[model samples]
Target: MNTLSILPFFRRLAGTCRLASALLAGALTLPAAADALPLEKIALPPGFTIELLARVPNARQMALSPQGVLYVGSMRAGKVHALPLDRDYRPGKLRVVADDLKLPVGVAWRDGSLYVSAVDRILRLDGIDARLDDPPAPAVVRDDLPKETHHGWKFIAFGPDGWLYVPVGAPCNICEPDPERYATILRMRPDGSQLQTFARGVRNTVGFDWHPASGALWFTDNGRDWLGDDRPPDELNHAPKPGLHFGYPYCHGDAIADPEFGRKRACDEFTPPAQNLGPHVAALGMRFYTGSQFPAQYRNQVFIAEHGSWNRGRKIGYRVSVVTLAGDRAVSYAPFASGWLQDESAWGRPADVLVLPDGSLLVSDDQAGAIYRIRYAGERKASGIPQ
Candidate 1:
């Protein structure tokens, strides 16, 4: 080899080594997205600890299969994710089960199939439990829904009656759209047949669950916006039977009449809310605490994921809340987990909640793009310490 060729070769080798060193330094300095999410500042109740379980981008609603796979849906990611849990229920590698869907924020698992709700349609993936790695193409369950995107995202679940329940939000904030179509909760067979409106006047309900004792349907309905910061309130409603209207555009909260539509109908004409939640809290997903891990008082209660208020003068509800129930009535409402909002800035927002088989609870946060596991570790370790 000539001297000139050897000198050029050495120069090239030095350049390659420098590039490798810079890349390694960058990799070490910039941590994974999940590792950057701070969890120590979060506050929970005594004997309960919260852990960052998995990092799922735009994580919204969640469904757990009987075989321990956690299927997650997203709002803007346009994909559904599956995370297989290990023996200790730790999430394994993440997999994209479906992609290129529009605002598919709801997921429900039934009979080995995964049901997902996009804005104007519902799709089902058959044998999803067995094919998380190579998911099958989805079959359209229903597509005739209204196409409006305003408040259009839905939260779906199969009821105790063995029917799939879906919500269609009102197109506008406070419009009197077609009574038969908008602002209603509709139920149908798993194949999307026999579809009928189960409840009406629901402005937007992103979450609901049946009572463990009575099997009554209860849901969290987000009240209309621009109702001032404290006038109208979000609702936790109960509908044991069908054909009930909880008052929309006409009446809000218990009896706060709407300015434009109040004169059209009397407030007494419609059923009031079962519980008036915080005004403009943006409560989304809720579930009955069917777990035995928490204290005795926590059994069969309701856990609500308040996604946090957007337009209010002050921020509210970037945390998980608890609603205590006596029989069918909500007796008390309190914060179960909080501290996501430090003053005006929010680091995380709770989206959906699911109860585990071992009685722990899983809360999904779309703001921080993570899922958190809340477990009870007895009173000795109750001081917000990780158990």
Candidate 2:
């Protein structure tokens, strides 16, 4: 049978009742028809070209194992997928590793195991690299997380400290919930013991990374909505130590006090953002460029995936952005790739970015259901920025 023809049957055979129901209901959203690669439409700084790496259904967060296996998780599809690559770094067959999960949007691979987050729980697939064809059942690493589904899907990573860092978003758009359970970033041992809040007062942060040189944590925060189009901007924040609070319900980027809750606390009580981004941009995943394939200037800079705006009258941030840093401060922010949003109609929404061992970057588009590889093949230049 053709590869496309067998997909539905494979899903039926592998999925549980709930996943099958979601499939039958036609809930797996896909992108519209576009030409192959469509690289012409996506504007990038010269010397860089983006290639389609794989087509994963509802591909969200991505994790690459030490052995070169690419694992992806989905939110609406409730599934986790694996793509084994060939020697050329091209993808092989796509396999469903786990299904029937609850908003499994985060994945992390470490020491021969794959960890997936599903709202209230964390599951691990042991020795997953060796069993792509027939994945083993996932064992529960932890099941004590809050079960709220509103902004509850997590983005997880193993920090430089060797602990698993997980974010629990505020249950509402702007609510002062319990500090310990909501609007906080939590870190725990790999075995799920000794869970503690790392940071607090964060409304929602779907992406973060540690500085390559300083080892400090930097994260992106989506500003609360309904404040018009230009009031509060998304934030790029720095947390050099634990116990720091990035303003949430009380204060927004910089000293912009929230209209409703601003009276409760002074804006100076919380740490301000390192840099403020466009309002309603829905900034998601971010990574500091540690690859040598790009020019020297691109080193240690941050790349962010802007998932685009949902409530804005004019759309913004459907592509990747670069933030320049100078000793813990964001000096500048600009676009690295655009044209995904043409006249307010977006053909793609970037969800996450990952750097491969070869110094190339891989970006996941959940709306387009695809992953793209960006490589720098140009000559020795001054910078990767578009002139």
Candidate 3:
């Protein structure tokens, strides 16, 4: 064959090789998007539909405003995003509200002010509702928080008592810390006055909600990792009153004695969890369903986002679970929404769950950088529009 003919054949072979390489790269990237990690896969009951609402990178915790705006905080990005929702709970526009902070992981809105938790500071923006399109300068409400990066980011909320509750997590996986450091929950005035320890011996609790009927506090605690796959399950605790202790370091999930912190004390000395969630589940945001859109059974049920596990050999806890509260204790548990983690080899980590004013559920997935909306279609809506 002539030289020109050979040149064309070689060119075709090179193009074919490039195409094959591109396909391989895409194949490797697809699983991370397709498979659900513990927090990303939520299993809802029948008749409820869950759809991806927004995709946010490294979302850690979320807060919803009274006007129905969804604000999300990110750990890796060190930023907060405001996601606007339409009538159907679908995200309409996503805007970066603030950025370049020190690992902002939590966000809250109260009285038109926005409060955000950075690693070593609690910052707030006044008249946040008026500046939704243009975030004003943030003022430091409280500083001098411990500089330890691990578990330093916080979930901040203004409880019914008008006190701001902040959780300081243990810096290390397991260690006795200075009195000012982790394993405790603290409450203070909105102006950072009258700081008091509300609860102690709590390793790390990222999500909490006040009881609708009783005004008590409830939170989720993550168990220590590398303690086998089944021992020391995570916890869902209730603080009927302040100064309560949910055993950490000394005890774990229900009555399981910690191998590291247990010595001469009995697990009964500390208040046990309302229920044991699971081992290494990394439970994050939680909310109580008090809306009327769902059936009567869903009222007062607790919904939690399990962020899943990384240290375990086999994956677990990539979905949201509901805890049925019977008076003071959890009677039973079941999955609410799932399908985020597509397979055992893949992962999509969910971080937070928020309920909107319209009685819809919004779930934030950090790994996949997406938020999902779950809503119940009533009989009238389920059927075609009335003729």
C-alpha lDDT (0 to 100) for residue 118 of candidate 3: 92
Alpha-carbon local distance difference test for all models: 0.90, 0.89, 0.80
Please provide, for model 1 over 52-155, each residue's C-alpha lDDT reduced to its tens digit, 9 standing for 90 to 100.
78888899999999999999999989999999997799778889999999999999999999999999999999999889788999999999988888988989
Clashing pairs in 1: 47-382
TM-score, cand. 2 vs. native: 0.89
Better of 2 and 3 by TM-score: 2
TM-score, each model? 0.92, 0.89, 0.85
**True-vs-predicted CA distance for residue 340, candidate 2, Å:** 1.3
Each candidate's clash count: 1, 0, 20
- Candidate 2 lDDT over 29-119, as tens digits, reads 3343332445468888888877778788788899998778999999899999999877678788889999999999999987899999999
